[model samples]
Target: MTIPRSSCLLLAGALAFSACNTGTEQQSSTAAADSLHHIVHRYYDDKMQLFPIDATFNGEHQYDGLLHIDISEGFRQRLDSFAGRYLQQLQGVDTSGLSSNDRISYEMLLRELNMTRESLQFHDHLMPIHQFWGLTLTLPQLGSGTSAQPFKTKEDYEKFMQRMKTFAEWADTAIANMRKGMATGYVLPEALVVKVIPQLRDLASNDTGNVFFGPLKTLPAGTDTAFASAYRHTITAYVFPAYAKLQRFLQEEYLPKARSSSGIAGVPDGKAYYNYLIRYWTTTNKTPDEIFDTGQKEVARIRGEMEQIKNSTGFKGDLAAFFQFVRSDPQFRIFKTPAQVLDSFRAIEHKIMPGVKQMYALLPKTSFEVRQTEAFRAASASAEYMQGSADGSRPGVFYVPILDAKKFSYVGMESLFLHEAIPGHHFQISLQQENDSLPRFRRFSWIGAYGEGYALYCEGLGRELGLYTNPYMYFGRLSDEIHRAIRLVVDVGMHAKGWSREQALQYMLENEPLSEDEAVAEIERYMAVPAQALSYKTGELKILELRRRYEQLQGGQFSLKDFHDELLKDGCVPLSVLEEKMKRRFE
Candidate 1:
C-alpha cells in the first residue's frame, strides 16, 4: 500500500518550489494557475461523460433529463478510455512551477483518475444493482423528491414517466447482472435478499398516496379533465406493470440464487476486493484486522469518556444499563412532530454558526438545509447528506428520516449536525465545487476515506464549536464516535468473520445507546454493504493523524486555514494522494 515514489512521487524531497517572490513571480503564478484551470475544466467535462449524474450534481445540466446510465461493454470501454486519457492529461500538466495548492490539486486529479480506473477493474458492473446502495435506491431518491425531477411543469412530469419506462429495461439488466454475479459468486446474502423483497413490494405498490405518485398529484392542476383521467390511466396501465414486471423478475429469478453469506469476503475474491476497498476508502494499506483492532481500542476509550459523563450525572449504573436509560428517557425526547425533528438540526446551525470562527477561517459558499427523508423511503432511510447541485442553485441538504419525529432524541443531535452540516459534507464538498482553480475532477467529487474521514473529523470539532457542554450532549458525541468505532468491528465481523446479524446487533446495542430498532437497521445495512462502514472512523483517524503530523513538522508556522484550504481545495482523493500532498507541505 506504500506506493513507490518512483516517477513524480510528490513525496518528501519531491520538490521544494515553496519560495517567496515579487510582482512578476505573482503574475507568473497567476498565469500558470489560469492555464491549469482551462485544463481542469476539460478534465471535468470528460468526467461528466463518464458519470453524468455526478455532472448534474456538479452544476452541468445538459444531462438533466437523463435518468438511465448505460453499463454495457461499449460504455465501459469508453469510460475506461476517457479515464486513462484524463490521467495522462493530468500528468502532462507542469506542476513543477505550481504553488502548493496547485500542486495538491494536480496530485489529487491523478489519484482520482487512477481510483476510477481501479474501480473499473472490479465487477461492480456484475453487482451493478443492489437492494441498498445500488440503482434501485438511487432512482427513487432522484424521482421522489427535489433532486432533478422537476414538478413545476407538465413536461417535467412526462419526462419522469418517460424515464420510468426505461427503468423496466434497467431492471431486466439488473436481474441479468445479478444472475451473472451468482455465477461469479458475487451475490447478496439470502438474508439480505429477504430484506430486499419487502422493498420491491413497496416499489410495486398500487397505492394512490405513494411517493411515486408525486408527479400525478400535482400535475399542473390546470390540465383538461380528459388529460387528467388519461394521466391516471397511463400510470395504472403502463407504469404500474413495469414495476410489477421488475418485482416478479427479482422474486422469481434473482433473489433465490442470492448467496448465503453476509460479508463482502463471502463473495468471489471478496477477501481481496475488501482489502482493495479498505485501501481505497482508508487511503492506507491497513488490513481488516488492523482496522478491527483500532476500532476496538477506540470503542473502549470512548466508553471511558461516556462513563465519566455518567458519574458526573450521579448515574451509578453499568454501561448497558445507562444505554437503556438513554433509550427510554423522556428527558431526551423533545421532538413532537417531524418539523420538530427538522428544527433540531436547523437550531444547531444557528446556535453553532456563531462559534464556527473559533475553528474555521474558510466557509463554504454553498448553503445547507435540513429536510425530512422522502416519505416512502423514510422507513428504510438512514439520515443522509445530499450534495448540492453543482451550479449552486440548490443548497446541500441533510435529510433526516422523521417518520415519527416524536421518537427522535436530542442526545446525538450535535454530533449528527456537525457530521452532516457545516464542516462535514456541506463544507467539504461545496467548497471543492466552488473552487474553480482545482481540476474539475478534483473539485466536485467523492472518495469515501477522504470525504467520510473529513466528516468524522468535523464530528471531532463538536467540542471546539461549543456544543459539548451539556453532560448528555457530551455523551452523545461519545455515543456517535462509539457507533462508528463499532462499525469497524461489526462490519468486518459480520461479513469476513461469519458473525450473525443478531451478533452484530447485540454488539451495537450493548456498546452504544442506539435503540434496538436503530441497531437492527444498522446491522442489516452492514450486512447489505460490507466494508462500507469502516470508512468513517478509519478515514477520520488517518486525517487526524496527518494533521497532527503536519502540525509537528510546521512547528510555529502551521496555518490551520491553509491546511484546510490546501486539503479540501482539491476535490476528494484516495488517502495516499492526500498523504502525499501533505507530505510535500510538511516535509
Candidate 2:
C-alpha cells in the first residue's frame, strides 16, 4: 500500500481549500459549511495530537515527542466524551441546503460517528490493545529511517529513542489490556496468535538486518560517526531487549488463552461486531447469509467462465490440473528481478493507456510509480495501492511484492496494475481529492465495501482496457476473481461454520492452484479481517448490475466515456448513494 508515482498517479490538487477567496455568498455558506468542516478537522486534529502515535501517521509532526496513552477506564470515558461531542456536531449539521457532494460527505460522517459510538459502547477501549495489531510495535516503524517521520536531525534520533522508552510503558499497558480482553471473552484466534508469536519472535532478533535496525543501517550519512554508532548501540542493547520482553510475554502469557474459533461471534457481542462491520464496510444492510449466497453464485459463475476458457484452449486435463498447469508453468516465470517485475507492470501501463482513454474521459492528474513492497511488512502484504497526500505533496503509488520475482508468475500482472494502480484506487481516490466540495475526511477513508468493491469493478474492465488478452492471462484474471469469491465462502465457513485453516486451504486448492503459501496467507487475512474479502465481489456484482441496466436503458445512446466519468465523479460512496448519483446523472 506504499503509494508510488507509477501505477498510481493520484495528482491531487496541490493546494488545500484554504486558498479559495470568499464572496458574501461564500462567506454566508461558510458560516455553516466551513464551520462544519472546521469542527470536524478540529476534532481529528485534537484527538490525533492528543494521541501522538496517531498524529505521526496522518502527516502531523507536532506530537512527535509524545507517546503512551492513559487507557484506563478513565481513558474509555474520555473517548466516550469525544464521541458525544462529535455525535452532537453531526446532529447539528444542516444537510438540507448543502450541495450534493457535501450531502454525501455529511451522510458518511454521520454514519461513521454513529458506528464509532455504538462500537465504543462495548468499551473496546477496555480491550484497547491486542498482540495481533498492537500500537507498541507499529510506533517504531512510524519514527525510524525510511518511515514517515523525518530522521535526519540529531533531535529526531533522540526523539525516537525517547519514544522507545515510552513504548515499554505502552507494551505493559498493552498486556494489561489483553488480560482485560481475556476476562471478557475477547481473545484472538489461537491460529492467529501462533502467527503473531513468530512475528514478535522475528522482531526480537538483535541483528542489524532486522527492520527495527533500519534506522541504524541507514542513519543519515552526515551524522557524527561516534553519535551514530552510539545510537545504534543503545537501540541494540536496550530497545531490542525491551521488545524481546514484550515478545516473551506474548509467547508465555497471551497465546494460552487465545481461542481456536475465528469469528467475532466467539467474542463478546461478536455477532453484533461482525454485523456492524458488514454494514460498515459494505455500506449496506447485507446479512452474512446474503453475502455468503452471493459469494457462492459468483464463484460458480466465474468457474464456469474458467471452464469455458479451458475448453477453448483444449487443456485436456481435469479442472484442478489445469489450475496447476496455469500456476506452475515454466513460461510464467519470466520475472527474474525487481526491475523485471516493474518492467512487466510498465509494459501493462504502456499497452493499456490508449484503451483506458478509449473507455474513460476523466483521469487522475496524479502520476503513478512502482516500488518494491516495504521490506518490513512484505511478508504479510498483498499487492495494494497507497493513496498520495490529498494536497498532492506525495504521489499515489502502487507497490508490487517481488520477494521472489521468478517464482511469482507474470500471468495476472497487468490486471493487478489495472486494479491497484491507475484506473482503480489512484483514479477513484484522486478524483475524490480533487473535488473541492467534498468534506476532507471523505477524500481519505477506508470503506472496504465501496472503495475496494469499486476497485474490483474497475478490474472487470481489464479486457476492454486491453490487459487480459492471452487465454492464460485471462484465466489468471479469473483465478484472482475466484479468490475473492472464495473468500466469502471460506471466511464465513471458517468463523461461522467452524471450518479449520486446513479445511479452508483444502477447499481453495480444490478450486484453484494457488500455492500453499498464497492460500494460507489469503485465508489468514480473512481471519484477521473477517468478511472483508466479500466486499469485492458483492460490490462488483452491484456495479455490473448497474452497468447492465444503463446499457439497456441507453441502448445505442450509451457512452462508455460518459458512464465512466459519471461513476468516477462521485468518488467512494455507499452503494445506495452511488446508485442515486448514477441515476441522477444518467437517467
Candidate 3:
C-alpha cells in the first residue's frame, strides 16, 4: 500500500459535452462551459502549488523544487480556506445542461470538496506521518532518484536538494505536531510508535550507503560527475543530520509519552474520528456496525469455501491445522532465486494472457514490469503496483518484496498477481491514465473503493482465467480473499470496537496462513491507517453487486467484455456515482 502515488487527480470540467451541442446550443453553453472549465483548471493549478510533492508525483515538473508541509497550522488553514472557496465557486456551476459525464465530474468535485471540508474538523495533521506510509516513508524513495521525482538533469538534482531541505523542515514540524497531538490526546499507539523509532533511526544515520546516495552510484547517463560529490556532502551535512535530529526526537521526546492504548478510539473524539474515516475511505453512508456485520458474514462465507478446498486436498486436520500446513510446508516454498520469483509471476501472466485478452475489451498501452521492492523499505512493504507516468515515459511497476527467495511461496502468487499486477492496479490505473477522453482530473483520480475495490474484484477472475487449478493456488485465492475479509473485521474492530492489537493479531494468526511477523505488520498497518483496509472489501462488494445485477438483468444480452470496458471506461469514481451510471446505461 506504500505505492508511489496517492488518491485521484480530480476536479470538474465541461469540455466532454462540447461535441454533442448544436450551433445555437453551443453558443448558449460555451460561456458557462468556459467559465466552469477555467475554474477547474485554476483550482488544479492552485492545488499543484499547495501540494507540490503531489504535483511532482502527478507528472507536473514545475513543483518539483518545493514540498508542502501540511503539518503546520498555517498550511491547514490555507488548505481549508481553498477547499471552501472552491466548493462555493463549483456549486455555482449550472449542471442542468451539462453532459452526463460532465455532470458526474461535477458531482465528483463536490464530493471531494465536501470531504475535504468535513475532514478539516479533525486534528489529523496532529499525527502527520507513521511507519506504514506517508511523506516520511516516501521521501527516501524520491530522494533515491528512482521514483517519480526526476533526477535526469542538474536542475532536477538541485530541485531534489531543495526538496530535501524542505523535508528537514517538514520533519521538525512533524515533531512539533506530534507534541501537539500528545497534549490533545491524539497520540499514536505505543506499538506503532515503537516501529516508528526504528525507521527514524535507520533514516537518520550517517550511512553514505543510504538510498539518498542511489543517484551517485549510477548517474543517469548524464554529465553530472562533479555534482555527485557535492550531493554526497549535502546528504551527510543536511539529510543525515536532519534524520538524526528526528530520530532523537522520536526516541527521547516522543516514544515514552506515546499512548499505550492500541486504538484511535482511546483518543479525544476518537469515535467520531473513526466514523468519519469510515465514510472517507469507503465513500458510503453505512455505519461501522453495518460494515462489521458484513465482514463477519464474509469471513464465514469465505471460511466455508476454504474448508471445502481443505477437504478436497484430503488434509486430515481442522482449518487451523491446514493453515499451519500451508504456512510451514516446504513444497510451497520452491522459489530458488529472486529471478525465479519474478519468472513465476511472468509465467502466471503468460498463462492468463489469452483469457485476459478475451475478458476485457480495453487494455492499457502503458507497459508493465515486475521487480523487487527497493531495499530501504522492502522489509515493511507489501506487494503493490506503482502507477506509471501518464505520459508513458515510465512503465508501471509491480514490486514484490522478496526478502528471501528460499522462503517465498507460490501459493499466493496467482491471487497477488491478479490483485496487484495485470488486470488489477496496472490495468485499472494505466487505462485511467491513458484515456485522453476523460478530463485530466478524472484520468488520474482514484477512489479507494472504486480503484482498490476493482483490483480486489479482479482476484476472483482467476477462475475464469484458468488459474487456481492447483488446489494450493486455489487456497491462495481463498487466503487472499480472507485477508481482505479479515481487514474489514479488524479495522473496524480495533478503531471502533475496542479490540486490542493482541486480539487482532491472534485473530489473523488463527484465520490466515500468515507468519507472526506478517500478521503483526498488517495489524499495525490497519492501526496506522484506520478504516483503509475496509475499502478493499467495501469497494469490491459494490463492483461485484453491479456485475451480478447486470448479468441477471441483461441475461443472454449481457456482454461481459463490454461490461468490463464500461466499468473502467470512466476511470475511478465514487461507488455511488458508478452505480448511477451503470443503472442509466443498462436499465
Candidate 4:
C-alpha cells in the first residue's frame, strides 16, 4: 500500500482544515477536531488495555505480560461496559466542523462500538476454542519467538513467562466455558473438535523439539543460565501441563458432546447467529440467499473464462477434466523440496515488482518476506500474511503451507502470491499500519469487506502486474478467484441453508481444481468459522464495483494509481464508508 503525494496533501488539509474561515471560527473548528481525536484515541487506548495480546501484536510492548481470559463472563461484561462507555463519550464529540478523515474515524468507531455491544448477546464465549482461531492456535505462534512476542531481553523473557502462566489459567477457563457450552448446546462441531484435539495433544508434548521450547533455543547471547532454566521449567511444569489438561478435556469429556451438525446454525439461535455473522464478517446487510446467488453467478462467469483457457490450451475434455489434469499434472507440480516451493513464490514476487512499481506511485515502507508455515499447523493452515510491527521490527510474512513439496501445485502460485504477498494482504495491511495521519484505531482496524476485498481485487491486477502471462498461471488466478466465489456459496449454504459438510465439500470439488484434501480443509474451515469465508468474495465484488464506477465516472481522467492510493490512504474501512469516501473524492 502506497500513499501518493496528493493523498499526503489531502491528509494535510484534513489535519489543518480550510484556511478561509475567520480566526474565531477556525479556532472553534480546531477545538472540535482536537476533541474528536481525543475521543477516538482514548477509545483505542482503552481497547488495547482490554485486549493486551492484540496490543502486543500491534507493537505496544507495555502490556505484553498481560493475558485476559476474554471468554470469561467477567471479561465479557467489562468489554460490554467498555464499548458502552466509549459510545457515550463519542456522542459528546461535535462533528459538524470536523475533517473528512476525522468523520470517517468517528463513523468507524461508532459502528465498532455498536457491533461489539450487540454481538455480546450471542453465546460465543460458550465455545471459545475453535480449530481455525482462538488462543489455542495463537499462543503457540507468539511463544515461538519468531512471532510478535519479543525475546531480545531478559525482561522480555520474563514477560512471556507470565503470559505462559496466565495462559494455563486461560485454558482452565476455556474448559469450563466449553462444559457450559456443552450443557447449552453451543459446542463445536465434531469435525472441528477432532482437529483441535491433536493440536492440543501436540502442544502437550514434553519433547525437546516442542514449539514452546522455541524461545530457549534462540535465547540471546549472555542470557543468564538460571533464567533459561526457569523458562524451560515453566514450559515443562505449566505450559505442557496446561495443554495436556486441555487435551484431556476435549478428548475425554467434550468430544462425545460435540455437535454432529457442521454449521453454526446447529446451535441454539443458530440462524440468528449466522445472520449476525453475515453482517459482522461481510459488513453488509446481505442475506445468505443473496450471497449464495452472487456466488452462483460469479462461479458461472469464471467457469466460462476457464473454458476459454482450456480451449486455448487445446484440452480434449470438459472443464472438470481440465481441472483434474491441472491438479495431477507433473508439469504443474514442479517443486521437489519446500525451498523450491518458496523460491517459486519469491520469483513471482520479483517478476511482478517492475509492473507493480510502474502502476503504483507509492509502496509499503515495511519489508516483506515469504516463509513456510510452521509444521505443527501446516496440515490445517491456509496461506496468510502476518502484518509487520508498526515500528518495523518484524517484516510482514507470507506463510505458505507445504505439507509435501512434491504435491505442491504451481498452478495457483502466481495468483496466491499476488493475493497474499506483494500487493494483496501485504500492501493493504502494511499500508494501513504505516499511515500515521489516521487515528490509531483506523490505522489498525480491519473491515473484511475493505481489507480482504482489496486483497482479492489485487489478484485481478495479476495480468497488469506481468505475472499471469502463462495460460496455466492465468487459469491459476481464476482458480483462486473461483475458490473465493465457491466460499460464498458453500459458507452461506452450509451455515444458513443447512447444507451438510459433505455437500459443501462436494460443491467445492465440482466447482474448482482443488484436491479432496484441499476441498476438505476449505469446507471445514467454513464449518469452524461460519461466514468468514464469505468475506473475500463479498469484499472483492464491492471493491471491483467501486473501481468500475469510478473508472466510468472519471473516463480518461481516471488514474488507476490515484484510485488505488485513495482506496488505501484512508486505511481499512467499512465498504459503505469506503463508497462514501470514494464518492466524495471522485464524484
Candidate 5:
C-alpha cells in the first residue's frame, strides 16, 4: 500500500533545476494529495448512496429510507460506472508524493475499483438469494427491531416502511434475475435451494410469528394506534407477499431447475469464478492447489495433536472415537438453557479480560455484549459478531446461535468467545470505527483475509489468555483450527478439485468433531459461498507467520503487545499491504 519515493536527483543540470523543480514538485504534490482526498471522500459518499443498508449499519441514518434493487441490470450498470469513474479519478493522483497513510488509502481504493470492475463480468446477480446471505435474510434482521435499523421515532418507522415497500419491488426483480440464471447454468444447488424455501416460508407467514412484525412489540408508549396499524399492514401487505412470491418461485420454479452438483464448477465458467473468489476472499495470489496442499499438511499436523490429547485423557479409542465422545458425552453438553449457553460465553469474557489487557495495549472505546442469534435464522446461522455504531450508542454484539442447549458443547466456548467477542471482531472492528485518523472507507472497509484471519489467530491465543488449561478446551481450540484447515481442504476440494458433496461431508466428519447437523451446515455454507471458507485459515497463517518473523528479527526487543497493536492499528487491509506496512514499520 506504500508508494516508494522518487530516486535521488542525478546530474549538474538536474541539480541546477532542483531548486525550481522542488517548488514545482511541492505544488504538484499538494494538488495531487488534495485531489486524492476529494476522491476518497467522494467515493465514500457515493458508496453510501448506492449501498444504503451498509450506510445504516455504519450509523449513517440519512440513507435509512432507501433500498436499491441491486440484482437489477440498471443497478449493476450504475455500480460499474461508479467504480470506473472513481478508478479513473484515482489514476490521476500522484502516489509518489502522497503520505504513507494516503498511499495506503490510494492503493486500497484502487484494488477495490479494479476488483469491482472485474467482478462485474460474472453473473452474480442472476443468483441473488442464498440461504446464508442476500436481502431475503438481511431484511428480516433489519425489521426485527434489534438490528441496525432504528425504530426509536416516527421517522424511523416511516423510513423502514419505505424500505419494506421497495423490498417488495426488489423481490420481483430478484425473481426475474433468478429466472435468467435458471436459463443459464448459474442456479443454486438443490440442497441450498431447499434451505432457502423454509426461510422464505417463515417470513411469508401471516401470523404474529413473522419476524417483520417484531418492531410492533417495542413501539414507544402512547404511540399513535394508526402508526402501529400501518406497520402491521406494511408487513402483511408488502413484506409477506414479497416473501411468499419469492418462496413460491424458488419452490416451484427454481428448485426444479437447481443443479444437483455441490460445487460452482457445475456452472458456466465456474472455475474462473471460484478463482476470482479465492483472490477476492484471501486477498492473495495463492492458487487452489497451493491452498489444498497447505490444508492437507495442517490437517495432518493438527490430527497428531488431537491424538495426543485423546491418549492423555486415557480415552479408550482412536481420535475418531474421541471426537464422538466429545460430541455425545453429557459433560460437554452441560448447558440446559440458552441463558446458560450465553452465560458461559460471558464468563469466558470475564476470564480473558485480564489477559486481554496484558496481551494488547490498545482497546476499543465501544462497549460489547453477548446475545443469542434470533430464532428465525438460528437454524442455519453460525456464531457471528456485529460491529457497534461508530458513535458507540449501541454495543457490539457477539451472537451465539443455540438451537438446542443440550446439544451445545462447552468445549469450544472459550475459543469461540475469543474469536467473536473481546479481542477478535469487537476489538478489531470497534477500534477501526473509532480511529478518526482513517478515511471513512478505510475505517469501514472489509478485507476478509485480514479481518477473519485476525479472528482465527485470536483462537490460538487461548493458552496465552489464561484458558485452555483443560485438555478438552485445548482440543476445542485445536478443533476450531482444524475446522478452518478442513475448510482449506474441502472448500478447494469441492469447488476446484471436483469432489462431491458426500466426499466433502465425509472429509469434514472424519477430520473434525462437528455434529452431523453442524457438518452439513458447514459444508453447505462453503457450497453457498465459494472460497469464503478459505479466508480464516489463509489469513491466520499469514498473521502467525508475520508474528514469528517479527519475534525472531526483534529478538529481545520483540513485544507481543506492541506487535498486536501495530498489526491491528490500521484496521483491516490486504495481506500484502499488511506485510509491507509491518515491514516498513518494524523491520
Candidate 6:
C-alpha cells in the first residue's frame, strides 16, 4: 500500500538521444536531441518548485521550509498554464529523430502533462483531506522528525517551524475548499469523515506527548538548550493551536455536511471523475467492467488454490468453514508480543535470503530493515515499505502494524515479507534511487500498476523463497492474492456499479478470511481512493504474461536473474510501455 512520493507535475529527467537509425542527417538529429534535453531539464526544474514536498522527500532540500497550498483559484490557474506551456513545448520537438530511451522519456512526460491537466478538471481539492492520503495524515509523519524531512541542524528546526506555519495556512484553505465542496455536493463519505476526526484530535491534543515534540526530545548531539526551549514554545503556542482549529472544524463544520453515500458517484460529475481515476491508477484504457471481470476470474483461480491447501491440511469442511477456521484459529495467533511478531518477519527474511540471491542478480546496496509501525497511526495503517534516503542515512523500512499481537495471523507473513520487503518494494525502489543514470523524476516516480503489480507478483515467489511450506502458510499466500482480487471486483462495483459499502464488506467476508474490522477498513480504503486496488492484479498479470512469453521463446537461453535485472532497471513505467520495452529487449 506504500509508494514513494511522486509529484503531480511532469517531473521527468532529461534524456539523451542514442545513435539514430532514421534517414535524417546527423546534424538535424543532434539539434533535435539538444532541444528536447533543454525542454525536459526545464520541466524538471519547474516541477521541483511546484511540488516542493515531493522534491524534499526525493532528497532535494533547497525548498526545505516552503509548503505549497494549491487549492486556491489563482494556484489552479497558474498550474493549468504551467501544464499547457510544457505540453506545447514538448510537442514542438521532433520525436522521430530521438533514441528509443529518449522517445520513452518524451512519451512518458507527455502522458503525465496531459493527465495532470485532465485531473485538474475534477475538483479533488474539495474532498482532499481523506484518511488515507490527505495533508491531515502526512503532516504528523513529517513533523515527527522520523520521515524524509530532516532535522539535523538548527536551521532544520527553523525550517520546520516555518513549514508548520504554512501548514496552518493550508488547513484554512482545506476548510474553505470543503465548504465549497459542500455547496457543490462534493463532500467525503461520512464513514471516512468519522475515521479522520480521531486522527485530527490526536494531533491536536496539545500535550507534550504529541509527535510535534519528537525532534526536541532527541536533539541532534547539540548543546542548544535555549533554541530547543523556543522550539517547544512555538509548537505549543502556534502549531498545536493550528491542529486544534482543524479538529474543531472537522467535528463541528465538516462531519455533518459529509456525504451519506460511500461512492464518488454521489458527487457532481463523479462518474466521469471516477473514470479519470481508473485511467490514472491503471495507466490503461480498460473500463471498469473489464477490470471487475478480471478480478472475478483471478479470485476463482486463487480460491481453487486455497481449496487444495485446505484439503492438504485434512480439514473436513467447505472452503468458507476452512476460511473461518484460519481466521480464528488460536494456533495461528501464537505471537505474544509485538517483538515476537517483528522477529517472525526477520525469520522470514533469513529463510528467503538464498532464493532472493538466485532470483535477483543486482541487489540494492542500500540497507533494509523491518520495523513496527508507529503506535499513533498503526491502527489504521496497513503494513507498508517506506523508501530510504538515497545517501543511506535512513534504511529502506518495512513497517508492520502489530495492533495486537494476539490478533495477528501468521497466514500472510511469508508472502507479505516477499511483497513489501526484499525482492519487492525495497529492491525495486532502492535500485531505482541508487542508479544515477535515471533522471531524478524516474528514480522516485511511481506508476501504481508497475509498482504495486510487481509487489503482488513477488508474492508468488513464496515457494522459491523456501517459505510457504506449511499448508496454512501456503493458504496465507493464496489469501493475500484473493484479497487483491476482491479489491478489483468491489472497488469498481462500488464506484461504478451501484454496489453499497455493506455489499463490498459482505463480499470480502464471504470470500476472504478477514475480521469484520479489517473488512471495514479495506472497504473504506476503496471508498476513499477509487481504482487504486486494481493495480496489484492488473500489473501482476501483465508481468507474468511477459515472463511466460520470454521463458517459452528463450528456452535454455533464458535467465531469471537477467529478466529481473532488466525488468527493474528502468524503474516504474506504464504497463504498455514496460511490455514494449521488454519485448524489444527480450523477444
User: Which number leads on TM-score?
Assistant: 5
Would you list the C-alpha lDDT of every candidate in the order shown?
Answer: 0.75, 0.74, 0.86, 0.89, 0.92, 0.86
Q: What is the TM-score of each candidate against the true structure?
A: 0.86, 0.87, 0.94, 0.95, 0.96, 0.94
| Descending-TM-score candidate ranking | 5, 4, 6, 3, 2, 1
Q: What does candidate 6's lDDT look like per residue over 1-587, in tens digits?
A: 54344631223321112234233456777788888788878887788888888877778788888888978777788899999999999878887778767777787888889999998999989886877776777777888998888898888888888888888788888889989998889999899989988887888787778888899876778547888888887787777777788778888988889887878899999999989988888889999999999999988998988888889889999999998999998999989999999999998888889889999989998899998988778878899999987878888999999889988999899899989998899999999899877666677788999999999999988897788888888888989999999999999989999888999999999999998999998999999998889888899999999999999999999999999988999888999899988988897
Model 1 gets an lDDT of: 0.75
TM-score of 2: 0.87
Best by lDDT: 5
The predicted structure with the larger TM-score, 4 or 6, is 4
Q: How many backbone clashes does candidate 2 have?
A: 13
Model 5 weakest lDDT span, ten residues long: 2-11
Per-residue lDDT for 116 in model 2?
Answer: 67
Q: Which of the two, 3 or 4, has more lDDT?
A: 4
What is the per-residue lDDT of model 5 for residues 409-439, given as tens digits with 9 covering 90 to 100? 9999889888988789999999999988999
In terms of lDDT, the poorest run of 10 residues in model 1 is 12-21
Segments of candidate 2 deviating more than 4 angstroms: 1-35, 50-55, 66-74, 123-137, 140-144, 152-162, 216-222, 225-234, 237-239
Candidate 6, superposed: residue stretches over 4 Å from native = 1-24, 221-223
TM-score of model number 1: 0.86
Q: Over 4 Å off in model 3, which ranges?
A: 1-30, 220-226
Q: Write the per-residue lDDT of candidate 3 for residues 317-416, one digit (tens) a residue.
A: 9999999999999999998899999999999999999999999988899888999998778888888898888898888999999899999999999999
Q: Show pairs that collide, candidate 6.
A: none
Q: How many residue pairs clash in each candidate at the backbone level?
A: 6, 13, 4, 1, 0, 0
The better-scoring model by lDDT among 1 and 5 is 5
Please write out the lDDT profile of model 4 over residues 1-587, one tens digit for every residue: 89999999998887665553466677887998898888888888898999998899899899999999898999999999999998998888778878899899889899999999988999988988877777988999999999999999889999999999999899899999999999999998898888888988998998877888999987888998998999999888888999999999999999999988888899999999999989988989999899999999999999999999999998999999999999998998777999999898898888889889877777999999999999878988999999999888899999999999998988888888888988889988888899999889987788887788888999999888877789999999999999999999999888888889999888899989999988988888889888888888988888889899989988999998888889889998888888899999898
| Candidate 4 runs further than 4 Å off | 1-25
When superposed on Cα atoms, how far off is each prediction in RMSD? 7.6, 10.8, 9.5, 7.2, 4.6, 9.3
Candidate 5, which segments miss by more than 4 Å at Cα?
Answer: 1-20
